[model samples]
Target: MENTRNVLDFFQKIVKEEPDVSAAVAAIRTLMNILENFGDGETLRGLSEELRKATEEMKKAECSITSVQSGCELFQRFITLTSLEQSNFKDCKEIMKKRGEIFLRKLQEARPKIARLGAPFILDGHKILTHSKSRVVLQTLVEAAVISKKRFHVFITESHPDLSGVAMRDELLKHSIGSTLILDSAMGYVMESVDLVLVGAEGVVESGGIINKIGTYTMALCAKEMHKPFYVLAESFKFVRLYPLNQRDLPQELKFSSTIIESNHSNLLDQHPQVDYTPPGYLTLLFTDLGILTPSAVSDELIKLYL
Candidate 1:
């Protein structure tokens, strides 16, 4: 229980100190810290169990668990792979720590690579529409403007319940990028004006679909109907092994924020869902560190990693 509290505090502290850092990265870093300080002579199974408990604690502390869940899953996979190569438990722990550091370094390098890949698509005078706040998306915009010197306007949805889009708009304006903040309901009204839709994912599921901010699916539907291309900017680590046929197909814990899940309210209708699944069909392409991949390619990547 104490370790779990420490995990939660460290996770929250990282988020508070670095507002741009994704929860997934913070979760990974927190786990790495646990790996470093984990007591000597503990069995690999014991360490894995401890890590699982810490992950659950962090999940309960956050409004959205997609990133935390995915990060833990990937980290656990690293442990599994390391254990296969080493017989000594201590050697396996050391190897995992070294590999974990490398993995984190790669993740840090991913955004810049993705920015370069995504920048070409931001042509001069293109009117881009983005939902919510994504560090990768923001960096790509900055890359297009600062590095490529492309002139463009951005329309951001006022991602409600959190108003994260407001923050995104402010950040873009800080970079001297022209932007307009619109209501979530106004996506359709702005669809004709938007040349393309760019969004960030909390989790890119196996079916090439995405689990993201609640309104992403609606925005994708709007883009599809308007015949506008919808692009997603996400890192490779954001991918998860899950297939959701629809919203209801999502796991219960993945649907609501910690607050909603812990709420005493007997009626679920009173609570708003934290995230939604956007099917692969609605996505034109995914801008990832791996490359520009069509939706179908996501499963191929997952197969190589998991299978």
Candidate 2:
């Protein structure tokens, strides 16, 4: 029973500490695997109940994290819950999928607010630029496109190393959406023509600032210089409570495989290329499941529910 509590605590920590979706998904899968292989029937039942509680906790945490209205206290409450083990792979997968779907539904609920912010449309076929591939952003854009009828042309940065943009570009093409793929360096040149900028956040801070893929900060800076509006399309669950007090003093860690580093043979090789942080000032508003929020207002709004 004590071991089960330890496992549960660890599960909650992974959900809280890991900012990356891939990391979170991987952690959840690991937990599910452990439960599936080792959990007894009683443990499985407990885990299912715990998962439901986690889902509820996640909803509250989302409000806190995205709105920047509160601290990490509420999320910490859920972290104290006990964990359960599972005995069946099928059951574990089903539970994870169900939880994921619930999370996605929460994201969908924010669509109306996202649409409202991008309102009055850019009539002259506004050029919107973004980097990295984001499923949430894609869904939001697709919905907007359907409503605006090709009133916007999207420019995507060919996210290097992973080149995830290619897949994104393909997906857009399938929808007959007009889009342009640009090299990361070309962002400045493209910024001049862009009317607005939109990107996805990997994690949002309590202050309403955001951490995203590398090059996002550069894009935001460029947008700031150009006096263009920059919006972040993200769900509340992506908000992470912990933050480095001194942003510049934070350790720079590698985000990708060591193989890429070992093969370079030169010290100048790319070491870290996964994500970057853009300060709150660079963003205009946060389009979240709850509503649109400004940097200063997010925390107050979040605090209403979770504090």
Candidate 3:
């Protein structure tokens, strides 16, 4: 139950500074750290059950899609470690520790590669529109400006309900990149002149679609209408096997609240979903750690990973 609580709390706590992949990596690290502190055989067995419970809890919640996928990966890693040469208790602990170290190292390596691989898309003299918040997207833009020495303007929508895009805008400016902040409603109005649309994903499904902040799908539609090249910058780890056919198939959390709306009605916020699904058709390409891939190529990559 305690591990269950930790998993529940982790899923509920949204760290704005970290994107879905970052948060997931942090969660797995935390879990591994906790296990490392208690290395006895009985404790390991107990932790195994607790970790499984935690993974199931994540599955049941409105977790970031990367959290769901990473949680599963961490559990599988634990299982693999347990299956290793268990001739000695100390050796088993060593294996688990080494596995954790390797996982962390891989996660660290993927982030920068994602930035460098996607930064090329941010050419000079182009206006890029992005919504919500994505650390990877910010890093990509910053890399283009600082490392690549390319000058570009970034237009960010003030992602509503939380206004995370304002943070993105500020971060871009801090990196000495040109940026502008606009309201969520101004996506169409602001995107008319945008040469490219670079967005980040909470999860990239096997079907090549992406799950992101609520306004992303709309922004993607607007970008498509404007004939702008819309790109998604995602680490390969954020890709999930789940394929949602439409927004309705998404597990959207709705809270009934009228506090934000100065209205006579009380249930105005009842149907507000924090995230939505953007179809693959709206996407121009997915710049991933594997390579720049068309939306339809997502399933092929997943198959390759599994094989």
TM-score of each: 0.97, 0.64, 0.83
State the number of backbone clashes in model 1: 0
- Count clashing residue pairs per candidate: 0, 5, 0
**lDDT tens digits by residue: candidate 1, 81-166:** 75557877788888888888988998899899999999999999999999999899999999999889999999999999899999
Worst 10 residues of 1 by lDDT: 258-267
Q: What are the per-residue Cα lDDT tens digits for candidate 2 across 1-307?
A: 2444454455456656663333334233434444444444444456556554443333232212222211123222233222123356455545544554444444345545665555444344778888878766776677667766656788999987678777778777877778999998999999999889888876676677787777888998999999999988766655555354434522233223234434653752446646667888899988876677887766665555343
Cα-lDDT of candidate 1:
0.89
Clashes of 2: 5
Q: In candidate 2, which residue pairs get closer than 3 Å at backbone N, Cα or C atoms, i.e. clash?
A: 35-86, 67-298, 68-299, 69-299, 69-303
**Best by TM-score, which number?**
1
Better of 1 and 3 by lDDT: 1
C-alpha lDDT of residue 154 in model 2: 87
Residue pairs with clashing backbones, model 1? none
In candidate 3, what are the lDDT values of residues 1-307, reduced to their tens digit?
A: 3456665665545433354446567556655655566546654566666666665555544445454554456435643555456875556666777777776677688768889888877788988889988888988988899999999888899998888998888788788889889989998998888899999987888899998888899999998898999999987767776788987776432121223233425554455766788999999999887888999999998767555
Candidate 3 residue-pair clash tally: 0
- What residue runs in model 2 are displaced by over 4 Å at the alpha carbon? 1-124, 245-270, 301-306
TM-score of 1: 0.97
